[model samples]
Target chain A: MKLHFSTTHEDHRIALLAALAISIYIIESAFPSPLPGIKPGLANVITLFTFLCYGWKIALQVSLLRVIISSLLLGTFLSPTFLLSLSGSLLSLGILMLVHSLFYPHYLRQYQPSAIGYAILASVSHISGQFIVAWYFFIPHPELFKLLPILMTFAVILGIVSGIITQHLINKLCSTHNK
Target chain B: MFTIGNILFKTTDFLILLSVSSLIIWLYSIFWSTDTLYGQAETLQVQYYNQVAIDYPLDTDRIIKVEGSLGSSIIEIKQGKARFIHSSCRNQFCVFHGWLNIVGDSTACLPNRVSIRLKGTLNPYDAIAGSQ
Candidate 1:
């Protein structure tokens, strides 16, 4: 017996991924951040996974849905934090697509980028977008620029961690599906 | 296939990413790090609510008091280093900043509207932290 849903398979898959991403986002937000603007951004793993498994379009849909739905759930809709998150997500997605198209095939005739490569590129662009938005719209201070190094360091660490996790999960899912 | 935990981990990809990240960090440090303090600060300038209260040489060991919006702040210059000793502000951020010996180091008691800035040959970077 198979379960029946109103939505198509593609819609169901996106909805499931969005739910997972939103759950991760909410859970991450519950934890206390060591610094004001620092976060693990673990939810990005889902986006990375979707991008690798499906394609850029599904990944983009999942990411946007996750951010908007999660922000609404967290009661941060239309707030400064929401704006920052939206900008970061959009910028990161753009960078991820660019890197995917440009480097995915050239380096080794591979179809797509390695998980770590995509993670690092997306994370760096995400943090940069957020920082630029925060500096321009919120703080507007040179002191804010000083946080770049610290933020980038955090981005690198988180990128590696999430990339490894996404790779492992994809391998597991793929192997099980093949079986 | 180079596999780590059943996943095809590419050595070339990892190396490329590592090099790129390191290069970025290196460039950032070169451009932003304040390790090379621009010429020695010859004097200290105290400002209260945007008004210049006093300008004094760092060669002397002395304390200067300046009144601000909230109350008075005591700035002490000793051993070519200057610091805020006391302020009426609840959070003593300025006082806690320890000392300012570099050309562009500064401390501000925002609540009290008092700021201490070093005066000398201006440096490209005012301050650099994290890359020790």
Candidate 2:
């Protein structure tokens, strides 16, 4: 498939989304986390918005580009942090796509998952992927698995928050475009 | 009305949220319930090369020297708490682990083949969950 941003409009939209996501990622990193691996993951808001507005292909592109470009800007490219981010993004995207397909079959494109469902699934999958990677490759300790409950709790809370924000943004955009 | 992908936030979405929240609560309770016995360790078991070396009551305040694969380790037990004060291992992970006052807490010095585990009936998990 032709994955390139085919038109100037498409390019502009992708660039805007990527910029928003990257900035959110960088800013979130500046905040102090109560725990080492706990963060709100606010950048996912833009990705979810793009997926709801556009489609999975563009959403995937935007999400991957955001992770790569943000990692490079933060000087974490090729580091363990970068690997974790990449793995989380990939896993979340895969789960989102699967859920999307399941909720909206090929013939029924109108019925898609609600924002809350998408966000919860994405967040849970993303954290699970990172936790597995950190436990097996980085720490290799049993104590790390003990942190799962706390992390999952945070994921659920942050997912709902970001999902609500994305839903609002999508609604505003749609209303404006309809006028 | 806020919506995304033509799907509105409806009663169905509320139901999903409620179910997910309950599931998370259940998991949290199972994993981190404070009702489980903690800080009630009755016995301290030391192992060398996967074999039991010594078992002692945790009520006393004393230091024990254990011989392992590499060299000797000094384990200190005080005020119902046990810890490795000194070990010949290079990493010193056991020493840095601070204390093992809980029923299921444990520490190991892989290089010296020495491990200490607290044993009690109310320990929640049989073994720490992790990839083999």
Candidate 3:
């Protein structure tokens, strides 16, 4: 017996976005790191953009695909790098979905998380999730806590930067799509 | 709409940004405080010529003298920070290495065969705990 799979429009969109993000991830990894284990994570802009435009379901799919595919391409699959990436993606996605469910409903629409809000939350959580997993499962050094302030500083700054980029993209593209 | 320069976002987005910024400040206060790390990450371990390293307390400012293969090396601990003040080594690389305050920080005077390492619970015990 043979099994067949059907693809939907949503699947195609997720794949396309994920491919874009994977390309960004691979390119970013090739650059020299000023500090070990720190990257700007520019690829996250794609995930944030998808979440803002399409909603959490598609965003989650895009994010997971990006992590899996990027790790496979970079030869980090099942390694510590892959685990850290997976944990960060899962955590950021979990929070994104949680926030979306709470606000994207009936009367809560007025205070809906804008692209900037979602981007900041996702990026900040992304770094922090990687930090905690590194501390617990891999390093476990208490001095690692010292780097947290610096790391979070980078995270917050990068979050704001990415948040602005995501907001700008939403302004340009989302408006065009809603019509 | 909340406008930052040219980019525009909702009031809620600005609020989220405000709260997250404050969170970074809070983390800075907790983990990056110089006052806390000064006394906590103590002791500088100095060694030479395959001899077991001796732990020198970083709390009291003092000059430590260690005998290396070539000549004596001087290490100074001031204000909970250690550095090689003078070394018999020709290159003077160890003295130029500057301050070593953080745990696991190390520098060596290769010609004199002398080395100094910052020792603390922050690294060794944690490594054992993690690998086990």
Candidate 4:
């Protein structure tokens, strides 16, 4: 049985992906933490999977669509703050695409790169994009470089947690498929 | 093909090492010296505010001290008038919005809902934070 039904199998795959992406965005926005601006990006895991199961093109499409859709739904479409999120997602997707290409080839069985790389890269890119947005928003003074280390620390911890969760899920899926 | 398990194990180990190293470095940077903490505090303040956004220019003495509220409001400072300081807000982020110790400059606090116009040093944190 095909676990992920494509358009040919379950034409609703796109919608399902979209719905899942929406949930991810909500979780990202609503879930507050002591460390400001940190997110698990649980939805990106789906993007990674799409990139692996399908191709980079589809993965990119899913991410872009999800971001735009979520931004619109959340009423942040035209706001500058929303732009930060868009940039982060795009940069993160770019990195994930690179990772997916390297690890999940056509001939691969039920394995992929360690979730650590994804977690780290995704987090780094996300924070990087955020910093860029911050740079533009703040402008002048040119004194914000001081916060990079602290932000990076937050990214590292969140990335580890997200990566571990993604890893567990992937393992579970593989095991389930085997059974 | 690299198995996912192997990749995960290796990445986990690497992350563990990296985290440990960073923790040690941060600790070293923290207790061992005041430079790192002060440096970080400066950075945090700047980044949190989107970098230094001076609301006034130098050489202006019109000072409008914001004593209450945490919101940015415009105020005109003259050559010899200075008033406005302290705020009810918890963070006092507005108090840090800026200072006008000169002749015609102005500073506004978004958090404290206050603005000060004066002619003096734009570097408010200079005296307190020192040498950033």
Instruction: List DockQ, one per candidate, in order.
Output: 0.24, 0.19, 0.46, 0.09
Candidate 2, residues A79-137, lDDT tens digits: the string is 99999999899898898888677766565454455677688878888998898888888
Candidate 2 displacement at residue A105 in angstroms: 2.9
lDDT values, one for every candidate = 0.82, 0.81, 0.83, 0.57
Give the clashing residue pairs of candidate 2, or none.
none
Prediction 4 global C-alpha lDDT: 0.57
Worst ten-residue run, lDDT, model 1 chain B? B123-132
Instruction: Grade the docking of candidate 4.
Output: incorrect
B5-107 per-residue lDDT for model 1 (tens digits): 6656666457647876896687577546654336668789888886746788999999998888898999999998999999999989888889998887888
Rank by DockQ (best first): 3, 1, 2, 4
What TM-score between 0 and 1 does chain B of candidate 2 receive?
A: 0.67
Q: What TM-score quantifies how close candidate 1 is to the native fold?
A: 0.66
Residue-wise C-alpha lDDT for candidate 1, range A79-178, written one tens digit per residue: 9999999989989899888766665555544545578767887788899999889999999986666678778878888887888888887776644221
Which candidate, 1 or 4, would have the higher lDDT against the true structure?
1
- The digit string of per-residue lDDT tens for model 3 on B94-118 reads 8988999877778889889998888
Instruction: Give per-residue CA lDDT, model 3, range A1-179, as digits (tens).
Output: 99999999988989889999999999999999999867888899998888778877888889989999898899999999999999998898888888877886778877886766887889888888999999999999988888887887787778778888887787777754221
lDDT of 2: 0.81
Residue by residue across A1-179, what tens digits does model 4's lDDT show?
Answer: 76974455323665677678778877778878766666566777776555544556766777788888888888889587678877887888787776556555666423444665567677777778878887877543345655666776677777767777666666655443210
How far residue A21's Cα lies from its native spot in candidate 4, in Å, is 1.9
Write the candidate numbers in order of decreasing TM-score.
3, 1, 2, 4
